[model samples]
Target: MYDIYSNAREDSWRFTLGKCGKRKLLTIGLNPSTATKEKSDPTVARVQKVALNNGFDGFVMLNLYPVRATDYRTLPSKVDEEAFSENIQKIEDLIRSEKDPVIWAAWGESITYHSFFRRALTEIISRLTLLDVSWVRFGEMTASGHPRHPSRLAYSWSFSPLDMEGYAHSLRP
Candidate 1:
């Protein structure tokens, strides 16, 4: 099944943001970097910092394939469909338990493109029509001044609180 860890020492996945009761946003990622790897993913840290600064109090960061050892680049091959299914169920459980509306924010294109999320969301949409859930893209910028994807802006002008607070403000409703 999907292996989830809470502490930063046990896993690279860390929730650096301050928890203010139930979170209004839930962030999802493909998986955490190998713990033994010297360099951690800068994008993950950036996401955590930005989300916290923007006042997104609650986040559920998930790894579609939760295994201790696996190549991140070749993720499609390593994914266990059964385990992935179970992980989504776990996420749904969290969403159901939340008291406020929670947005489903995808960390990168990898998560947006993953079939597990896209397909599962279609089903979730039908069942939870009144949940007020939506998807927001994160970490599209890079440290080198180059954009993560050429078509998208260096940062999400639409979602970045640093770049623009309009999107965050609009979420209040």
Candidate 2:
């Protein structure tokens, strides 16, 4: 798989930890948390568990922006457009390699915080659509049409890829 997070300051980027190949689950989230060796981020753990249970042998992750920040407000106001654009291309390539992929649109409300971030996210999904990839949700969407945050998903919930026209409409750039 293309290592989108392999850059020098890659510790800031979050990525998949398990098996990766065909029939993959590519999770889309906000910025990554401050996970360390002593503790794993609960959200990433939950997504990994769900992907494994759903027969997805491979997993990947793509975020709206490439930077890492535990809190959204701490993110840089100006994105590194070159790095961000490269990561987006890597995401597109990863999805193309999967025979039947499930992209988890789990960005939650962070999409509402910045117009630039939201526009980049919408463009990523638009590109994915051209590739005919489907999006899956673990639980209910918020009023703004985002899937429940990974931390909010219940262990018993099932995955489903419902019509996202409502979400698409809400993300107009």
Q: List clash counts for every candidate, in order.
A: 1, 0
Question: Model 1, residue 78: what's the lDDT?
Answer: 36
Tens digit of per-residue lDDT, candidate 1, span 1-173: 11223434355333222233445455554554543223334444554445565567544454444433334555555346555555556666656766765443443344344555445444444445556455455444444221232123333443532221332233222
User: Which regions of candidate 2 deviate over 4 angstroms?
Assistant: 1-5, 13-18, 35-39
Off by over 4 Å in 1: 1-24, 35-41, 64-71, 76-79, 111-117, 120-127, 138-173
Q: Score candidate 2 by lDDT.
A: 0.69
Please give each candidate's TM-score.
Answer: 0.53, 0.83
lDDT of 1: 0.44
Q: What is the C-alpha lDDT of each candidate?
A: 0.44, 0.69
